[model samples]
Target chain A: MSEIELDLISHLSEYKRIFSFLTAEDIMKKELITLTPENYLSEARVIMRDKRISGIPIVDKEGKLVGLVSTERIIRALEEGIISNKIKEYMTPREKIVYFSPKDTFEKIVETFERYRYGRYPVIDEHNKLLGLITKHDILRAILKQFHSIYIHDRRREEYLNREVSILASDKFIEDKASFRYDINTQSISEAGEGTALLKKVLEKRGYHRDFIRRVSIGTYEAEVNVVIHAGGKGLILAFFEEDGVVVFVRDWGPGIEDIDLAMKEGFSTAPDHIRELGFGAGMGLPNMRRAADRLVILSQSGKGTRVEMVFNLKEGRD
Target chain B: MKLKEVMNTLEAKIYTGEELLEREISFGCASDMISDILALAKPGSLLLTGIIAPQIIRIAKILDLSGIVIVRGKEPMEETIAKAKEERVPLLGTKFLLFDACGKLYEKGLRGT
Candidate 1:
């Protein structure tokens, strides 16, 4: 689904492939109960009740997902006596909805569900076509299906697989490693660095030294700002806590940097004059990231996207 | 210097974090470019900038700055005020130009980081 997947897969161990190879498309329910934007909340309420489903995806005539109306919205509309209103007025808009691509790995979907705490997420294609819906039950069923093929006769192995998959699905692994991941909304330039700010707060609460948090947050902020300024307004920020350091990744599906070497040079910027007016695009984003982190590697393809991985060692003092 | 003293030095107005006026700040940095601020700013320093975007509030929270002094008496956007209130980052406004405000703070024995 993505070229970057192979690069990461090649680096992971053999056992990790089991989880990485399986994706949302493989597990998501193809048959879905969906509604159109023109549908009324009264109609949606009756459909949801008859189908016994808590939520439904709202799509256009072209089958592109436009919104989602959950049971909570249904109750709110009923309370407000607006049950007869159109579904668009009562649905969570597409811009705010957390969705998954068909090609996304199971681990990514699990992590997203854990982060957003949503009951279910719509699976869509690159064209925004509503492909399917994924839920926690779907994830568990996928794990079961995997185990059924391999450990059908081995009860012990089945137990181990169950334990492992649950660990992967829940926040247990993240809590143990202190990994923090967030989706960066690049649509608004003013909301940049929010993930980094939250990271700073978490590190502070965990008793990290002020300078250590500052270095990590500074590096993360620069990378995130790049996503907002250059990237087409969608990015992901993931930080994995190591024993003596931290690893952060900022990935954006933007036009990849044509020449990373030139981009790394101080004061080299491709940003236009309008962006410069907002106090960004000074050509210092990469250099600042380099200065703040102990090690920085930027992986990018011309037409695909750019992924910046920064490593910070706690034992090392500031440069 | 206490943040209150810096507020007095610039004859500034507080937009948020009024309860944090008693906090001590040692250094001051001024910049219109956020990258420079993130690259060069030190922890516990005061940030003086001509910008009032919401990202400034986030940067202040990340850098653990003592406060932000919006130079040139510019009105911060409503979203910026909301973010500052949420992040609890002290935000103040000043009528003096960026250069004069920095000079006044320097004259008062507040050094740069």
Candidate 2:
């Protein structure tokens, strides 16, 4: 097999082990847009169309989860001339559905996904109250986040990069040791990867191995985009090049993550609707960064800032 | 088998990149989940699915798929069509159901890689 293809097979299988370590609650969409069974069918239809959501939970007057109204049901209703009816008349009632608890892991969920072919499953607690929703897209995003842990930084890292750049540059008759940096504007997601893009091209041009370049690029891009989506303020990405790998430090000043433990969990995110809709937030960014690098260290102060240091070792398969 | 042969078997219409159908497909995959395809589809395979969204093109790009057959006669959004055209990924629509289209391709020598 070609080296790149064989490398992908090894990497993807390794990712399967890394990704199976989480439960449903860690990634479920907590801020829900729901419907009431008593509400007219038109309301659900409007919300689905407007929000680009395929399904919405139906709740009772007391906010207990009751059922779901999916696009399929709506289409069936439209064909049957039931659009004027209340959601209770056509929604898939709770008792007949396949739902998940907060404790179910992706290993468990993948079976359901493959067996049922449903687009999403609602997440509930012991009381059977709807806590949030988890979709195929969410699970996929979270899992694939691990799939590409290809890799990237810090003070020791800075020194290492300096040493490598100087040595590598000498071969080309250049003498300056330079560490790369980029300013990440929280509001400028469209431009978030400008730094990482150039960095990858430079490394590739410098004849780095394909696997090594991908690891550094993916890690740096994730860190850079995380700052743009979650940090709530301008941030900076600094890259260090070493002989064996790359290190990146994503430092941001903002309302820092309150719980580093919680933040490190896959599918954890506090990004608002604006960022989520723009496809920036799936709660996968940090865990992805963790897996991308061989060694990862996070430093943050609540109401202050966060600094994420990542190390990518070309020889190591995964941590 | 070539993507063009699969197209003729399913009686599908090329929505974008018609000139590219003569290219050979290394394999065939049937899935609506973009993430699964992105995570697992081998490069240069043919993807057959019922999903009609722009995300399909992105997944195709990530996997470097040979082409896509949107089964069940679903038309993608205009923007999705535009994206496929720009990305140079062949996108097609078939009147046959997803299972039937896949079966036809399988019968005509397309196997999952």
Candidate 3:
């Protein structure tokens, strides 16, 4: 292999080792709200809204994580006028899912998040039985908790205090980023990437690196595809350019995602066979968006709409 | 290998960018799925697909692909050809099936990305 490739592998393995000390069992949420495939989409939607959660794990009689239903599926069903349909018709089935075992280390989970960009992952046993759920926030909390102990032991209190002050002071200098908005017409799948293409051009004109532009385009394109395939084919794209990164907010007035947690799961798609035939609806759209963006947030209301926000942090000194 | 060699190996016909046949190509990938191409394809790799829409051409541009091969003797739409030309991406066609086309290229040492 080439030297650069070898260097990357070594760096990745070293990074993995640093976080391998903590496993999924250490940080996953043991308590979870779950449903069965026999449940109706309306029921799942109600549960997600009332519980203030974005997803629900669909379990079988054995409590296996057989499927998942989230707000994206709910919004899709609503758009199709099938809100009353069985959850089985809308849930992302188990075969396409990516799950983890309790023994999986934080490094593996972190790498998976970086690659898939899912909002949360289910921790299952060898038999595929649901155990707990883990999110990026949970991982952060665990890391922070670890740091607290390290700080207590190292006697680096003054240095830590000074670092925190510098971080807050740096935030004050970030000016209000310029914003741009565009109307997305999802009338045709062939035209789906246009909105993001425009964004790409704008970024390129500003002299951003091709790799950075590629990342933004991929994330924005996936968001655009979601709007087209699930959001009744009409939406809006809002972007803000920051000195260090870019923020994108994709909005749609169609049926909102009723359970976002399920929607964020990799391979959890609600698209029909027709859309699938076109090389889409593989349930990787959201994950792809997540993988490309440094951070992602989804907001939705059942009858109102859904808005997806993604932030991309650019590497310094590359441009 | 040059794209010209790939065309010769598959008995392909150029739909556009005949002047650019001398471009160097090192990798190949076949898929009808756009997401797969977006996620798996490497820069400058050649795409083998049966899809005939203008979207593929747009994707070719966005991903910086070397070119696209419309396999299975299928022809791309006029709009697709036009877009490929506008984007300066080579568009080619082959009478060989997708599998056979890929096999022929692989035999000639063209590897996948």
Candidate 4:
């Protein structure tokens, strides 16, 4: 079971204690660097440099967060023009602003931080006046406290699971249940087939990035085509994602590659002449997938199937 | 030079963020490669690039670039222009090639530090 579920089951009472200790207002930094919209971009840079901050709240005369200014905006202005004489010229105006209040919970703040990838958020009062700022560092500190609590709760959960397991064994003949089943197959082929489109759609639905999905889809399609035209049979392709990364296994049961190392070279395809005429095969499928995936492993036996397993890291913070 | 003056000098069209043209920038970098511009350009610098793609505007958004100048008379697609507009990033286009545009700006005393 996941740590979160374990905590929920074994430490329901301690959860309330954890909640009571973490309030949004407790983590906010009351001091913030503020700038007026009338200031020049150079002036904002100075403030940012002195404050050692990447972003600053742009305020009006009333001290409300009218917008935000960052280093990126400064660089953009210099490229667009030599100089921007005022902050309003380059300041990102306040629209779709996400702010937090002191009354909000730490969990909600964490959710917001994760969703937006914001390093810091401006804290506002009831009048929408800027009160302070809550940064990722502050959130991290709060989460650390929760982590400690979770650790203790997890220890208790292990004890509970142990006790439950003992009780289950005492009750004998408990049925074993299978939650899900997946069938994997591998084959080699040298021509493109109907499965290419189906595999592409499946990977797309599984939430791969568009660029990566395209490259993998093309690579897999080429591999399939290679199996049909050169290897003379369909290749096998299987993939599953674990917490650590995605694992894909492809194999071709056709006549095995004689020179695996030579075949791995770029532009080294054994595709038949007719397959080459279609402008689909360029002898770069294996190399392309190798470049795209975090790990690539291949095993082949003479006159037997060739197996290829590829693993791609679940890129952090992408979700 | 102020952004207003640069816009006037280039006779460029502002597709969006008209209200922000009065801002000031300190330096400038001219490049077509997004990665290079992101790495080399300092904060508060203007970016001049000849590449016209939605990815350009998306890069501007990620880097929080104040504005983008599309050179070589290349106009951004309508969707790209709209994305820039929505992000409140000013978009400008000029007929001059990359080198000449940078040179003219340099001649106009917009030297990078």
Candidate 5:
């Protein structure tokens, strides 16, 4: 059983406690069925069949999730008559797959399933470390368990789950001062918005002004995108929500900026051709990120890493 | 103003979510970029754009925009229409360009939030 389930089963007597704070970390598959890049496709196919799963998470020697081999990849491999190929030869690169982390809200999971309509997603940590696996079934099952037992079998339980849970963040779960961290992978457009999107909900639930949230969202997004587009290695975003506003720090273990002054100038870009082809790396990210934040400070060590700290102060009243 | 009046003013075709035409809207924002829409536009504002892709609908849904108007008589692809229907965002097509759509909506008392 997952930790959350254990917590729930133990807390059955006091089930009136907030069950909606439940997140992906509570039930993700800890004993993950994963594959290494060097693994053979035929062996992977057999393991997936035996496990009754349609996809296999691919990890690196460091146990970090580097790619995935889905049933679609399997079919494509068979179509090319290369069942003997290595997992890396057929797996979807890490940058392309849509994934969520353990801290992600159940609402975000539902939105992802509805938006992308994918069957399953690998659950990883901020460092690209594979933690567990999650599917639509897993989410629905966990959420359903949160009801009835907690609310004394009332119609309001149905209304709360059906209406408020889906439409907005649970107002009952708001905390004034909270913090969280997220790991960002390289080159994954799908995962680029994860941190910013999740942060928006935190700010929204606290009744932060829309324009304040927008500035935070915009600043966080550009920082996230910069990590994916240029950070040769992985990155991390640390978010702190205080009583007045929020502070975000984006740090990456990639080749740091050789010239901070030049990089900050609008329309000055060093992004390669393929990244440009993707319609990003237009040299505007740093400037935009700066423009959206109330206070922006950048610290970098060339050939080492870059750290950007941004502050968003709330207005006296709603904007 | 209700979306139907905006549709009439722009002479647009309803591509999806016809039932939502009765929904009221306050502001209009014109942009072809999803990032711009996501970062700038307010929820319940009208999105006037030339880019008619599934992504536009996704942005509108994420930002909780009131509806969309695909400009220059262009139609959103079938896939885009299907996603818009699922997302419950009304889609309108207008022969008028993006600037004209924004201008007319502005004259009618709409402003970007």
Candidate 6:
């Protein structure tokens, strides 16, 4: 097995109880209102409105949960012009339910929620009697805790991309003949890498050929990766493909780089020590971008942000 | 060679895409780096990777890879497998390490074009 696979396996095994850790009885709201199958549609609506709730469980005369009535069903009924006063006409008879015992863990709850994508789950006792409701908000809080753990675990990964890359100056190059005008936001460079890939796909979808797409992908990938790794999470990238070429604009909100000459030096990287351990920040990001792009420009203001624009010309009638 | 031949050569298990065993793959690249695979691998090539990320299937979609071989007994996440199925990309798993798996295919005359 590769080291990465082993690492992933270990990680999965370590977090086996992620769902269990997030579920608990306290997260459920026990003050649930019940309705009968014979209740009027308007009556259910009034109860929902008064209770400030979107749904209510339907119970039989024995107080056993039998169905569910929600706002969506009411809207559908209105759309279908169903003026029937019976709750049975609108309630979901075969509703999905989630039941949790006192011994059930938070990880299981999270797993169930993610698998089902349900807004709410009803917790029940050993006898399968509904005791309370656990809404999506409770699961979201648990997921947020997982995010926090991941963020802390990857702090070094975050710090590597928190520096500034120099922005080269450029005269405004705008084209009026383009089909679409895309305003590049260079302020959020962390997203540039993924954005560039998306832009290339967008161009190809519009009938750009393989070679032009490849060139744009290469240029955008390097520029965006640089923005993410060096711009301190404060760079923006905007791109649009035109009839003649692809235009890319990148901006950053870091301390303006002092020496473009030194910064662009082939192997010069100001990446912090921890970034090197992760196998990135070798300073080739900018040079690679320069090599791939046809025209490159940079603009910067100290303590504000840097903007870098690049254009890749395509062969006319080559689509 | 056919996909069944490749599977037999490597002693791979078919996780899904069983009906696609007759599909032909002329070449393969074994890499865990998704970016490298996206930038380097050719269309219709078989991908051998130990990395189990959703992006693996996403890259396959973008590049139009024929199949994915998750080596080292690694299984893709459920969502990733579902995507492969949706895209009609054959997925296989094997207990061999990446290098050994690639070497076995290379020895069987599956050249990287």
Docking class of 3: acceptable
lDDT of 3 by residue, A1-319 (tens): 2455334333444335334567999888888999999999999989988998777889999899999886887888889999998999778898867778999987777667666645668899999999998866677677655432221111233664565232111123222443667789766887888888888889889988888888888888888888888888899887888887887878788887666666667678888887776677767777677777766656565666666767777877753
Per-residue CA lDDT of model 6 for A111-191, tens digit only, reads 565455445666766665667777655544545444422211111234433743212212233445433333334433222
Off by more than 4 A, model 3: A1-178, A317-319
Superposed Cα deviation of residue A59, candidate 6 (Å): 93
Q: What is the lDDT of candidate 1?
A: 0.81
List residue ranges in candidate 2 displaced over 4 A: A1-180, A186-194, A274-280, A316-319, B1-113
State candidate 2's DockQ. 0.03
**What DockQ, between 0 and 1, does each candidate earn?**
0.53, 0.03, 0.35, 0.01, 0.05, 0.03
Q: Among all windows of ten consecutive residues in candidate 6 chain A, which has the lowest summed lDDT?
A: A148-157
**Native contact share for candidate 4:** 0.00
Error of 2 at B106 (Å): 7.7
TM values, all candidates: 0.59, 0.44, 0.58, 0.31, 0.49, 0.46
lDDT string for model 1 (A128-192, tens) is 99999987667767766554222111123455555533212222234335379888875778877
Residues B41-82 of candidate 5 have per-residue lDDT tens digits of 777889998776565665564566899999998878787798
Error of 4 at A112 (Å): 1.2
What lDDT, from 0 to 1, does candidate 3 have?
0.78
Q: Flag the better candidate by lDDT, 1 or 3.
A: 1
Error of 6 at A190 (Å): 12
lDDT of 5: 0.72
Per-residue lDDT of model 4, residues A6-124, tens digit only? 34334333233234446678778777888887888888777777878878888888877788877777777678773457887677777756788878876676667656655567887
Candidate 1 regions with alpha-carbon error over 4 angstroms: A1-178, A316-319
Instruction: Give lDDT: candidate 4, residue A150.
Output: 21
